[model samples]
Target: MAGFLVSCQSDARNATRIPPTPSEKLKSNWQKDAIDALTNNIRRKIDLDNSYFKRARIYFENEQYDLAINDINDAIENKDNVGDYYLLRGQVNRELNNLDAALQDAQRAEALQQVSPELYILMADILQEKKRFREAQNYLNRSLQMAPYDGSAYYVKGMLQSRIGDTTASLGSFKQAIDLNPRLLRAYQQNIIINNRLGNLNNALYYNNLALKRYPKDAILHFERGQFYNALNKSDSALLSYNKAAALDPKLTEAYFQSGSIYLKWKMHDAALKAFEKVKNNQAEYPQINYLIGVTLERMGYDDRASEFYKMELEKSPENQLAYAGVVRLQRREMGQYSTPSAREPAQPSAPTRILDTNRVQIRTIQPRRSIDMGTDTTRKVIIR
Candidate 1:
């Protein structure tokens, strides 16, 4: 079995990751100083508008969209005349998936004479997300006309093209975005995703390398690299990348799940169980996690423990065929039927689970668990984030 913490070989095929430079670390210092200064100014009741906006930008950059929205709201409350405030708030709302509110905010910014290439691009993004492709294309064209060299405009154009099922055009636009601004992270990400989906693993790896050079500390990039490596059947490299991703961000439960999957493929049941347990502890309801743990335990001959997890998985995902199979096998075993069932046995079809019904008892809160949507195509799409 491969060691879980094993370092990747410095081989040409592996494309060794570069360490982040000292200069890259220094970039956060200015951001920290700016946030501190803004906080102090806000506390002193001085220039609340600018201070709140500045702090809000920091929050948005840090991916703290809720905190950013609160600050932007305060900024707008202090001075409603600022178009930039609405624009920033619209961006925050866009990230939060509040498409209608984001559109309203963008329109408000336009009414306030804040019409810029960025505003147009933002509108296009919101429209594309809403599946208003025609309107999104119009806005995107306007943004490009305003600032043809704008990397963000091209990024939005690429996203719009992708939504419209124009993967080739989207790839071209993404390349243009990268040419305009090599530091545009989203462009590289889109390129990598599209290339991988097109079965161009070499191109995907090349883009992944470029992105890692610029964003060596980004955990998502590492996780994506691991996926690419896994797709290429470079299991050792995939494992190394997954381990690096987990080390970079322990809360990234998907990395652990992927690592466990690789271990299970190798029949390293103990290692797989350890990795799956980490995912379960971090995110108990992670998709297929309980079912996978049950499989690992069953492989190790712990039928009782595996049966418990299989039932737990069934409770969470009624249509999980593998979990259902485990339940049947273990239940049969309990009845003294030691003969193993065929692995190729088809699972019985299950009734569709009702998510919500107005005629039923009015439950105010419902925590939905992720489940397989059997109706949808199981094949991966190029339109991933």
Candidate 2:
């Protein structure tokens, strides 16, 4: 019986394992499906990451900065390993004017890629906007070190130099940027301003004219031209330029103010009054506008109207010298002192004069002429009748 039991055990052991039955096969198939689902889920996660980044880029390019930020935020939250995720988030934050947040993200990106000049440039721009000139300069220098031929970095450095009152350096930087990329409009504009500040009107005009050639309808360029012309004392040309600027942009208060000032200086009271009136109606809080109106009115001999405007100006700016001067002049006029005839006699006609000699010219007749008799021993005085 034991031998028979051992033989049966051996047979059982040696028996071929049956292929999976239909139900078992179904179970096996189910297991395989589960494994495949898991594999697909992993791939989907990866695809989601890629898709988010792609969509975020699209949003950023379309100027939907908020959406881009949200998408990038999700991507980073899901997996913070991607350096580009942080970099893109930083760009979105910058577009939204969230400089602090942008700086933090950009710094993270810089940590991930030590040699990224683009990141340093972005940081430099934010620092520049915050007026952190020294810091901005340092970052710009770093960016330049990494990418020696970066036109944008040079342009930004130029602007930073200008803000810090380093004109020579600023000019060199701007020129370098222009040489690298001539399409930089801002560099051209700043170059003009620097030239103007240095009293290089010809260069200023030349560059300004160059800018105008590029942007013919730019009101700011025309306004700048007007300023240059005014500096040259070319009032007519200045007025024409100012008029063109004002016509191009009616809401430019400075242009109107400048036009009014030019007219006032030229004693074109009517035109000045019109310009000042526009300013008063458009921007009444401008104390100088009120003062200018008063001045123009006074010039036109409208004392009462001028006084009213002057008082209004004083109400706005109590210490305004122009308003006070206008008021004082108006008061003097009202008191009849400024315009009244002189009370002192018109000088009595001077006695007629005649040339007595080539060497001496004297009055021909006088109330009395006293002379001394030199020949007489006794001192004698003779009155020439």
Please list all clashing residue pairs in model 1, or write none if there are none. Answer: none
Best by lDDT: 1
- Each candidate's number of clashing pairs is 0, 0
State the lDDT of candidate 2 residue by residue for 21-96, as single tens digits.
2454575564344334323433565344544555566567556788778777876776686667788888788878
For model 1, residues 1-385, the per-residue Cα lDDT tens digits are 0221121122212321212223544757756756666677678876667668767888987778999999999988988877788999999998888999999999999999987888999999898878888998999999989999999898888998888699999999999999998888889999998999899999999999999998898899999999988988999999999989999999999999999999999988888999999999999878988999999988887888999999999999999899999999889888978744333344556669968767877758777988876796668676867
Top TM-score model:
1
Q: How accurate locally is residue 93 in candidate 1, as Cα lDDT from 0 to 100?
A: 95
Give the lDDT of residue 182 in candidate 2.
70
Candidate 2's TM-score reads 0.58
TM-score of each: 0.70, 0.58
